[model samples]
Target: MTKQTEELKQQPGLILQPGPSGWWDSERVSSPCVLRCADGKWRMWYYGGDPHFDREINLPTGRCGLAISDDGVHWERVKGPLTMGAVFEPHSDPNRFDAAHVGVSDVTYNNGLYWLWYFGGDSSFTQVGNMRAKGLRMQPGCAVSADGWHWLRLEGPYRGALLPVGESGEFDELFCGFPKVVRDRDGSWKLYYHTLHPEKGFLVGLAVSEDGLHWEKAGQVLGPGSAERFDERGVGTRHVLPIGNQYVMFYEGVNNSGYHCIGIATSTDGEQWEKQDGDATGGSVFAHASSGSGRWDARAVGTPCVVPQSDGSWYMYYIGANEGGSDELTSQHQIGLAVSKGTDYGQWKRWGE
Candidate 1:
C-alpha cells in the first residue's frame, strides 16, 4: 500500500455529524466559517435556513448563525441569529446601493477587530421576471466588530463583479458568494470566492486588496476544465490554509459523472496550483458520501472550510447532502466537519485515515 493508504488505516474513524441537541439538524447549513476566538474558544459561522419546497420563492432567505466549540469537535450553536437584512456600508451612497437581503460568509481578524466579507442582493427575485435582471451583481462587501458579537457595516463592493463576459454583461451577473479572505506573507490581502458564469458553470476566482477596502481581480485561480481530464465540469467555494511556504486549497469539484466530490490542490506562490495525486485527488482525500448509513450527507459533500490549530491538528468544515442527486438548487444539505492528523496541509489524511 501507499504512504497515504497507510496513514488512513492508522487513524481513528472521525465522522461528520450534526451538533448536540439538533443544533443544525432542523436547518440547512452551508458556507461554514471556523475561527479560534481571542477568548480561547472555537467559533463557527454558517448560513442557515429551511429548504424551500415551494417553487414560488426564488431563493431561501439564508440567515447567519453562530456556534461555539471548546474542543473543536463537539459544538453548540449560540442562541439566536447574528446578522440580518441589507447591511449598509460606512460611507457609501445608501440610497443607490443599500437595497438587498444581505448575508455574511467568512470572518477574519485584523488589527484587534473582526472583519466579515459577505454577499448581498435581490437578484433571485429580479432574475425570475426579466433576463435583464442579469445586471444584478452579487459582489463582496465588508463589516467590522470590536467584539465578535455586535457588528457594523464598514465597506461595500471593495471589488466589482467578477470578470464581465462582455463589456455589456455584468462580471458576476449570475452570483458570487462564499468568500474566504486571508492576509498573505507579503502583507497583501487575498480573497477567494465562487463566481457563476452563464455558460462556463460555477468556479472559484481570486482578487487582491492593498488596504482591505479596494480590490482587483488577479485572474481565474481555479477554473472549469483547465485541467480538462480532472475538473472538467466546474469547481466551487474553497477554504484555503497556508502550510509552511505553500497554500492548500480544499475545494469542491463536479465531474462529467455529475457527482460532487472534494479535492485538494497546492500552490507554491498562492497563484498557480498543482492537483495532488492519489489521496489528494478524489477517492482517498475526497469522500463522495457521508460516514453514516442513512444520514443526510450520504449523497455528496462540498464547501470545505478548514482551520489549523496550534495542537498540530486540522479541522475541516464542509457541506453535506443526503439527496442522491447533484443539483445545487436542492435543499437536503447541512454543514459538517472532518479532522486531519497534522498541521502540514500536504499531509491531509481524511478522518479515520
Candidate 2:
C-alpha cells in the first residue's frame, strides 16, 4: 500500500446507535448536526424514530434528540422534555409546513444562542408512482434555543417555511430539504439545500438571506456527476466549510447501484464548484467498505458533518448502512466517525484506524 493509504485506518464500528429501549429514537437514528462550543463541550443534534412512529413516511426522521461528549468520541444521551425525550419535534399546528415530521440539519451557536436549521414535511401526502407517500412534501424551518433544550420556532411564509418549494418545472420543484447555512463575512447568510428530481436525480441549490430569516432562492449550485462516476446518481446532504481563501464542500454521492459515498468539491465563490479527485475510484474521497464485508457502513454512507479539530485534523460524523435490506433507503442506519489523515482533507481513515 502507498504511504498515504498506510497512514489511514479502517473504521471500527458505529459510535452511536439507536436510543435506549422505549426512547423516541429506539428504532433508527441518522442525520447528525454536531458542534464544539466555546466551552469545549461537544453537542450533537440528530433525528430518529421509535416502534410506534408513523410508517407512512419513507424516511427515518420523526423526532430529534441531543447527545453530549467531552472527548468527541464517547457520547451520553440527554433526556429531553418532549414525548419520549426529544429535544425538538414537528410543529403541532396542522397548517404549519412541518406538522408531520422533522429532521435537524444544521445547528450554529452565535451570540450566546443556538440557531437550528431543520427540514420537515407536512401531513399531506403525494402520489409517486404507485405509492402514496405521507409527509413527503418537505420544507425548511428555523428555531432558536437559549439552553439547547427548550426551543421557540420562528415562523415564516408559506405555512411556516423559510422558503417554499419551487414553481412548476423548477429544479427544486419537488421540495427543498436539508438546509445547511453558512454566514458570510459581510454579514449575509447562505443556505444550501437539496432536492431530488425524477429526471435530474439529486441536485443542490442555494438561497441567500440578508438577516438569516428572509431568503431568496439563488438557483442550482451543484448536481449529479458524469456518467459512471461515484456521484453519478447525484449529490445529496452536504456540509460547507470556509477554508482560507476557498470554500470546501463535503457532500454525499449516490451511485447508480444506490450505494452512497463521500466526495469533495471546492469553490472560490461558494456558488460554482469543481470536483476534486480522491484516493478512491470515480473521484470519491471516501467510499463504503467492500461489499459483503459485514461492516456497519458497507452498503452506503451519507449525510456528512465535518468538524476541524484542534490538532489540525478533521472529524467526519456520518450515517452508515448495511445491505440487510433490498433497498438502501429501507436499510437500518447508524452514525459512525472518520478522521482525515493529518490535515489532508482528501485522505481519510475510519475512527479506530
Candidate 3:
C-alpha cells in the first residue's frame, strides 16, 4: 500500500499548515510541544478546544495551547489556556488534571527547566449521559517552566493509577495517559505512555525516572499482542526522538484503518523496541497528503511530533484530516507536516498541498 509519485520531488521538506481556519476551524491541535526558545524563538505546546468545546462539546476537552514561532514554520496562537487551572475536583489544580481531557504532550528541556509531560483526563465524568464521554482515563501530568509562559503544576502522580479492570485485565481499568518524556545521553529519564487495558485496547507503556518524579514501569511498550500481530485496535507513543544514537518512536496505530496511521519504531537502549517502520499487519510508517488524486489523507494521520533541525533536517509534527469520517466521532482532525531527509528513518515527505 505504497504507491504515489507524481513527481514533485524536493525530498528535504517542510509542510506545516493549519492557521487560517482550516484545521477544523482552528480547534483541534493534538499532542505537540516543540520548544527551542532562548531568544531564537520557536515554541509550541498544543492541545486546543474552546467554543464551549468547539461549538458545544463535540468532545475532546484537551486544553493546553500556546504557539509562537520565529522560523519553526509560521505559528501564532497565544491567547490563553496553556495548562490553566480546573480539571477534575481537588486534583489540586497546578494547571489542573485535564479538566476532562488533555491527552498527549511530551516537550522537554530538562535541568534548566521546561519539561511538560501530559495525559490528563476526565471524560465528563465518564460520559455520564453517554455520547459526550467517549474514552480516555489518562493520568501522568506535570508542568514546569522557566519562561515557557508561567507554568507550575509539578508534584506526584507523574503516572499512577489506572491498572484496575481486574488488576490489569489487559488494560482499561480507567487510567493512564499519553505522557512521553525522553532524555538519555547520560541524563537518564525515559517515559513513553498511553494506557487502557480492560482487555488491552490501547497500549504502549514504559516508565523510568531518575529524578523526574520517581517512576518505574518498563512493561508493555507496544501492545495488542506484540509482534505476532494483532494491533488489536490500539497503540500509542506519540513522540520520542534521539536520531543519531537511535531512538525514534512516532506512534499512533489504531487498527482497521478507519483512520489513525503513522508508525515507526526503533530504540537502541531507550528500552528495546524494533519495528523500524510500521508492522503488525497494518503496514508501518505512514503519512499521506499528495491528494493529486483525492485520497491522500482523506482524514487521519495520527499524532507524531518530531523536531530536529539545526540544518540537518527532520520535522514531523503530525495530525491530519481536512474532512472527517474515520469514526471516533469525527470532527476533521488537523495539523500536518512531514519531512525527513537524513535521520534515515527512510526519507519521508509530505508537506504543503
Tens digit of per-residue lDDT, candidate 1, span 1-353: 95533532442322323233334223455667778887889877665443332233233224556677887755666664332321222223333222343446688998999887766543234442344442144556677777666667664533332222223354444566667787987788888877767667667878788877777777667766554333567777677778778888887877666556677788987789876653543432656554346644555667777887778777787776665443444545566667765654444444544
Candidate 3 backbone clash number: 11
Per-residue lDDT over 1-353 for candidate 3, one digit per residue giving the tens place of the 0 to 100 score: 21212221232222332233423224444555677677899887766553334232343434665678887765666654322322212133334345555543777776788876766654334433343443344577676777666676665643233222213354434556667788777767787777655445777777787777777766776765354232446776578778777887878765544445677778888677875544323565664443332442544566678787777777777666544453433554545567775755445666642
**Which candidate comes out best when scored by lDDT?**
2
Residue 78 of model 2 has an lDDT of 96
Top-TM-score structure, candidate number: 2
- Local accuracy by lDDT, each model: 0.59, 0.88, 0.57
TM-score of 2: 0.95
lDDT by residue for model 2 (1-353), tens: 84423322344747888777889989888988899988888999999998788877888789999999998877788999998999999888898899989999999987788999999998888876676778877899999998899999998887999999999899998889999999989999999999988888999999999999999999999999999899999999999999989999999999998888999999999999998888885789989888898887888888999999989999999988887876424688888888899999899888885
TM per model? 0.76, 0.95, 0.29
Which of the two, 1 or 2, has more lDDT? 2
RMSD, candidate 1, Å: 7.1
For model 3, state the Cα shift of residue 272 in Å.
Answer: 23
User: Candidates 2 and 3: which is better by TM-score?
Assistant: 2
- Candidate 2 lDDT score at position 291: 88
Off by over 4 Å in 1: 1-26, 51-61, 81-100, 123-137, 157-172, 225-230, 280-284, 290-293, 324-330, 343-353
